[model samples]
Target: MTKKIRLADVAAVAGVSTATVSRVLNAKSTVATGTKQLVLQALDELGYERPDALRDRSDDRVGIVAPDLNTPSAPEYIQELVDQLSLRDYAPILLTHSSAGGTEKYLQMLVKQNVSGVIFLSGVANESDYDVRRYLDEDERQIPYVTINGRNPNIGVPDFSSDDVGAVKDSVRHLYHSGHRSIGLITGPERFRPAQDMAMGYRQAMMEMCPDTDQTVLHSHYSVESGGRATDTMLDLGVTGIICGSDLLVLGAIRQIRQRGLRVPEDVSVVGYDDSPLMAFTDPPLTSNRQPVRQISSAAVNTLVDLMKGGNPPRVPFTFRSELITRESSGAAPNQSQF
Candidate 1:
């Protein structure tokens, strides 16, 4: 017969009262750090089964916060992260901040629930628009956090991102190889680091490809509408090839090009970043740079787990590689005399 270990036995070994042990097992905030550790150690040593409440702490419940689940890219990556977490035996709870109030409200809800850890995906909290410190309370701010695709030098949290600069370089290089001399770029808002890095890459590539042609780079909000407007302006400048920051933007540009009675690849070639869902099903399959979503998400989750286990993760940012996927949207540039 197996021996039964009682609460009093655990309390005696931990040098605390049974009531104190109960509080610790229940995850009451009043328990001191040292006392909680002692009780946990005692339970382990005595082969006593830990209470359900204590076992269900944040080490088991991981939180995922996203800006908008409606977006194609955000949801795809979130699903990948959740699948990885399930393989690790962790329960992932997803929260959205698409309401009127914003991410601050969702963050408060997570803190109140005492989640194990949090992963922020393309949300305003990861952006520079708002001071993240202002929204977090003193205690809540101390929780383990990880950001994807963004970073803050001031905060000590781990960040996983893609090589935005390298992606842009690859896009420009492809256009150059296709005999595109006069290239145009459509990018996101100036505040985003990825946008800034891509813009720099485009400028550098343009200078290297054609030293005399005027560099035509347009900046706009990361949306389909902005892409259409930017394409109209680039066409006015007589560009032979265009590089867009997103698939949605590329779609808009394609629409604008058709409206102007121009053909894709034959008249003007285009490249896009972020190989979003159903890109291949477009009228002309998109050629894009694919961000390594699986690699980045795994790195972020593993780093957060290390932090929770009292381990110090590297303070520097971890960047994953991106690959260029060529498709029908891009082709050899036509001769200037062909027009």
Candidate 2:
């Protein structure tokens, strides 16, 4: 049998007076956002079903945590995710992980907001050092949540992610078909699961494409500047084709290549992941892998809604394959004399 919860129990857990807990649950305007969040988290943690007043108010709001937008594709995914969330009669409240606090902080804070659910669009859940206890708490408290582009198995929540390994292999194979023997792969720090998968795919693809030629995988933070810095190292290694983990990184790679007096496709070919917006408008259109944003976002929303309805879904990740888009940025490799 479930234990009955009282206002005093909630107040004690939240470190506030019973009147304060009542005020928070009654939707008083005087309560601060952080204070209200604390009360809400406490109520949920105690396994107390919120009073009708609080449940109705919180049901109108849903929390969404956006990932680092340097990837370009993230912004697009966010817009779509927000749109989908709105259809469920929930106003999406956006949150982002900052250098000062980290993803865990924002997630803990979300509990206080009394959000109907929380959607994380690629954050620390992708990292190996993620605090499983934090996520487990959400689940233990019966909070509905979903993670996109990453997941921890112990979190026991549905994860929506793209096919990182297959995407890299396709990019490498495409470059190989363009007659480029000296190819390079650049991704985020090896600690990220996506980066590790990409590195593995690159090695496997390169081995099959050019067994005698040795290729190097450059690791860096997922940003334009980091991609540019990695480009110089790949250039020195005589890479005629480059594969980047993110579309923004590809732009950075092009800038660095031009700085060294090299032309894209003419001197070197490039392929990028996460086919960003208006990439074709650049001086040289970019070749990229198209992530299924609509499919993934729709599925994520559907899964989240199911969880909210108390329906149990499989905890396994739902993987979406990326399609390669070829364009002016990639072409036949330059002659050996050019290298």
Candidate 3:
């Protein structure tokens, strides 16, 4: 005769209190859906007979929560994430974040649908004021999840991301070496972690590389129009080289320079971040810092698969280095050029 698995056995495997497992078994509405599903998966893995409701509501979907999907980098990472998840025989359902609370709302919706797991690309987890309690709730319920790029230490999950600070510093250093003394930065709002880190790196690099000059940072929207405006502002201030926070910004800055009857690398040079797709095909073939998208994406997928199989990945963020790819957009700083 087969032995029956007890609540303690399920709780042990799921890493939740036995009482919580009991609540899950009893279909209590107070229990978090993801937590309940965790207990159910644990029970099934432990060879325990599952209740009828759980057995009937089993789903094979994976939820991907993204904060925003307007950038080229977003599509690049999403495509790779989708391709990797496909190999595991899991279909991806995109949950585009519509508002600040949308991430939590979508998480709840996905939990109700009983997804296999979740991967967060952009969400509240990256916010500066993030609360770990929300993620702790996910842990209590047994939902496995992974994050790409930004990470919160209290979340205690694997976060695959690139080195934003190093990338910006390297770009600044390169421009400094190319004879640019009056360097400036144009980045998005300060609320974003990437922008904040990049700004910090630029300030540090400027203090170390060109200590005699004052560093300038122009805050702007992450769009073509805004990039152009920000670039014009820096140009008016006599910046010989501009480091842009995004590829779109690079394109816009270039347009602004051309509109002022100045040639790239001759009058004012430009450097961009997030080596977005087709950057090499731009009129000047933009210079940019490459994000380890393929590496980070594959690592995120592998980590999620391990979590689903009851394996634990390191709770720390796995950081990858960003490489500077030089092209036509950046060159030696002109001495008092026609700006």
Stretches of candidate 1 exceeding 4 Å from the true structure: 1-34, 37-56, 128-131, 134-137, 337-339
Residue-level error in angstroms, candidate 3, position 158: 1.8
lDDT (Cα, 0-100) at 15 in candidate 1: 95
| Backbone clashes in model 2 | 1
Which 10 residues in a row give candidate 2 its minimum summed lDDT?
A: 132-141
Q: Which RMSD values do the candidates have, in order?
A: 6.6, 8.3, 6.8
Worst lDDT 10-window in candidate 3: 128-137
Model 2 alpha-carbon miss at residue 74, Å: 1.6
lDDT of 3 at 321: 98
Give RMSD (Å) of candidate 2 vs. truth: 8.3
TM-scores for the candidates: 0.81, 0.81, 0.81
Per-residue C-alpha lDDT of model 2 across residues 1-339, encoded as one tens digit per residue: 646769898999999999998888766758888998899999899998876446643776777777655558778988998899878777887876653167567766766676767777864555522453464343334567788887556566789989999999999999888899999999988877788888998999989889999979999988889989999999988999999998878989999999999999899999998888888787798999999999999999889888877688887888999999999999998878354
lDDT of residue 206 for candidate 1: 78
lDDT of 3 by residue, 1-339 (tens): 545769888998998999999888766668887898799899879877876445653445787877667765888888988998888788888877664356556766776767767788843466622433454243344667888876766576788878888988999999999999999999887877778878999999999998999899988878889999999898899898999989989989999999998999899999998899899899899999999999999999888888877687787888899999999999998877575
Q: Which stretches of candidate 3 lie over 4 Å from their true place?
A: 1-59, 98-101, 122-124, 128-140
Candidate 3: C-alpha lDDT: 0.82
- Tens-digit per-residue lDDT, 134-204, candidate 1: 43324422457788877656665678888888898888889999999889899888777678878998888
